[model samples]
Target: MPPRERDTARTRRTVLDAAARTVAKQGAGVSLDVIAREAGVSKSGLLHHFRSRDQLLLALAQDQVDTFAAEVRAAVDPADHAAGRLVRAYVKAIFDSLGDDTAISEHLLLSAALSTVPGVAEILQRDARQWEAAFTSDGLHPDRVLIITKAADGASLATLYEGGSNPAALERTRELLLSMTRGEGSFTG
Candidate 1:
């Protein structure tokens, strides 16, 4: 890429990183001025890329989803068990997300918005369904596996973000989730 284009891209990335840090530290009350300072960019330059704070937050959410999908897709094993692959990918993502302030901030904002915004979860849910269908095609019951996996993921993400390394709790939850997914017993809500 040309120098100017590269510079612009770098600036945008810096601003996004800064915004993610600010949001993670201060929640949604974070200010654009703080983000600009964190990025070491002038307010004018930051505004040139993201016209408004809402736009910046939206971009952060989109980037988090895109990065997550890419990571899971890359981690999935094509030849081995798909259900196991899904669980591994999900567990890895949830625990690993502890180190990612961007994803943390993005999820906090996106989940809140999902309650108020109709289409917020539509695309992500569709993508999740498609992935679950792939597992079902391998002979596992999609609905049962998806429910357990989603619950496991939720619990893992919550623990990780809360900085609570409850390994025993996580291990028991994982075992239960795997057992239910494997249809080993009569599991219920």
Candidate 2:
């Protein structure tokens, strides 16, 4: 790409990152002026990228999903051709994000913080449908897939509520969920 285009893309990313950080810190009620300030871009410059606050929020919502999906993709176990490969990777992504670091971790927590805003839920639901299909077809039983995903989700939510994650509890939950995906234990346990 050309330098100008690359600069444009970089500026867009900067704005999105700033918006996520701002929303995560200040909630959805935060103003565009603040977001632009946080991004180090003028209001006009931010508008050139996002157009409107809702547009920026919607873009942020999509960015959040994309970031987590990228994280899961990165964690995929290429050596494992059996079932639970995608799911185990997903489980890893969730637990990995609980550490309160990494850009991906911040997005996971930011997404939870933005869950109630308009457009965010629909974006999540759409992404979720795709994930559900992928999980169900990965050679795992439907029950195992559901149970494992929900458990990982609950762990993420617990991190949101608790303002951080408990390493020991997350470890235990992570162990149980990964085991279930691999068909090593009962889901009822």
The Cα local distance difference test for each model comes to 0.67, 0.85
**Model 2, range 3-83, lDDT digits (tens) per residue?**
999999999999998998988888888999999999999999999998899899999889878988999999998898888
**Residue-pair clashes per candidate:** 0, 0
User: What shift in Å separates residue 164 of candidate 1 from its native position after superposition?
Assistant: 2.0
The C-alpha RMSD in Å for every predicted model, in order, reads 4.4, 2.8
Residue 123 Cα positional deviation in candidate 1, in Å, after optimal superposition = 6.4
CA displacement after TM-score superposition, residue 113 of candidate 2 (Å): 5.0
Candidate 1: give the clashing pairs. none
Q: Model 1: per-residue lDDT, tens digit, 90-144?
A: 5455655544445655566645553243344665676667766666664556566
Q: How big is the RMSD of model 2? A: 2.8
